[model samples]
Target chain A: MIASGYLISVIAAMGIVTFALRALPFVAARWLQRHALVQALGQFLPLAIMTLLLVHSATGAALAHAGWPWPELLAVALVVVLQWTRRNALLSIVLGTCLYVLMRNFLV
Target chain B: MNDSNDPAHGPQRLSVLSLSAPVAMGYVPLGIVFGFLFVQAGASWWLAVLASLLVYAGAAQYMMIPMLAAGLSVGTIALATLIVNSRHVFYGLSLLDALPRRRLLRWYIVFALTDETYSVLTTIAATTSDRQKLLVALLNHCWWVLGTLIGALIGAQAQVALAGLDFVLAALFAVLTVEQWRTKKSAAPLWFALGAYALAYGVAAKHALLLSIVLSLVAGMLWQAKSAASGEVQR
Candidate 1:
């Protein structure tokens, strides 16, 4: 089991970081609005960060197991396509994950 | 926007429920998955509930599972959380005026601002009362925590380990990335991110995520400068 003390600390740190990010614009609305760079980063960062997270996590998962990353690639692609077409997050995640679990258990 | 024929408290309560109902649909199952995966990662169940209660951001909470499993430093996880949640900074910009004025209510609403909550608040009738808005946030929050509790309990009961179940995290990120892509003005960020990740991986596989994020930040600034200069030239 993961150490509870360490886990608590991580949770606390994450909570602080998330709250700070959410609260920043409210606390500094004027400053944020005046800065063109802020707007630029705002427009530029979200998609990039999300894409990186997806790629990084998928790569991490792919590396953890042996053999080709077909399962990883297929599942992620299925999720992306489902999300893009249906616009339903829960459906995409559930179906993609279910497909992945099935592949890892039976197919491989 | 006519509320003239509407009854006072009942209809308002119904509307709040209706506004939050869709959010509940998404949060409950997603929260359950987060809690279950987190527990399956070997942390205690209550911590998952605590995360859902406190961190409240779905993607960051999901992202934390593997980091915690790998025993990443709090600093690294915190940095990752900051990067993952930075979009929330922009979320509050559009909500500055709409939030309740009372300090307690306003701050609570601010604290509870998930993507779904933000969308619901933004789309709700402008005439929505501050209290009803609070209810929407509160109800959504409850759904998330409740789902976490349920899933954690279920996870605790299940002893058989299933391979690849943790891939839910990737699927969640994929879904989020696709949504972000849909709203994107240009696909340059996607390509830029992939390129940065590839370079970062080559430089240091262990620190790839952090290095890539730093690279992406630098690239974002340069991209913005280039676009701004181009606009000037066009003028």
Candidate 2:
């Protein structure tokens, strides 16, 4: 088992970092609002960041299994399409995850 | 505040509950997965609960599990968390005026500004009361912690061998990505992200996410400059 002391320290550090990031804009709202670049990035970064996260996590999952990344690709595609058409977050996640688990368990 | 029977208060309370209900749906299951994986990876169940209660950022929490298991340094994990959650820095930009003005409520809202919370706060009517906004954040946090507690207990008891269960995180990211895409003003960021990831992966597979994030930041700056220059020309 991981040491509680070490784990607690890690948690504390992560919490501090996360809180700092989240509070940065609120603390610096005047400066952030004043800058055109900040506005541009505010428009630009969210989509980029979310897409990177999706790709990175999906890639990580694909690498965990051998051979083709077909399962990851298919499942992610289903999720994107389902979410796009239905606009239901829970449905898309549940169905996509269930399909991925099924393929990983039975097919390979 | 104590008047649940007051007709005016009832709908307002219901609206807050309705708003947070969807977030609960996502957070609970995702929190469960995080808890189960952390315990199954050898951390104590309560530590999983602690991480959920403390860290509260879903993606970073999920990413930390394998790193912690690998005995990576705390500094390394912190840097990775920063990269994974860098997007949050921008989340508050849009909510500067919308968030509560009081010290405690404001800070608590800031601390609880997960992707789901941010999206919900942004979509809710601007007339929403400060107390109601706090309720939404508080309720979402509670759902996440409750889910982690339940899952950690389950994980401590039995060892279920299941493959691809952790794919829930990726699925969650997919859902968030779709939502982001729907509200996108231009498609350039999407293309930029794809190219950046491909380039970063080719250069260093292990640091692809970090490198790609850096690349995208630089790209966003350059893209802004270009657009600004063209607007100057038009003017």
Best by TM-score: 1
lDDT of 1 by residue, B1-235 (tens): 6554667777778888888888888889888878888898899999999999999999999889889989899998999898899999999998888998999999889999999999999998777889899999999999999989988888899977688888888898898888888888998999999999999999999989899999999988998898889878999
Clash count (model 2, backbone only): 0
lDDT scores of the candidates, listed in order = 0.90, 0.88
Off by over 4 Å in 2: B125-127
lDDT of 1 at A56: 90
Per-prediction TM-score to the true structure, in the order listed: 0.95, 0.90
Fraction of native contacts under 8 Å reproduced by each candidate: 0.88, 0.81
lDDT of 1: 0.90
Q: State how far residue B182 of model 1 sits from its true place (Å).
A: 1.4
Q: What TM-score should be assigned to candidate 1?
A: 0.95
- The docking category that best describes candidate 2 is medium
Tell me how far the alpha carbon of residue B123 in candidate 1 is from the true structure, in angstroms, after superposition: 0.6
Cα lDDT for residue B53, candidate 2: 85
What CA RMSD would candidate 2 show?
2.4
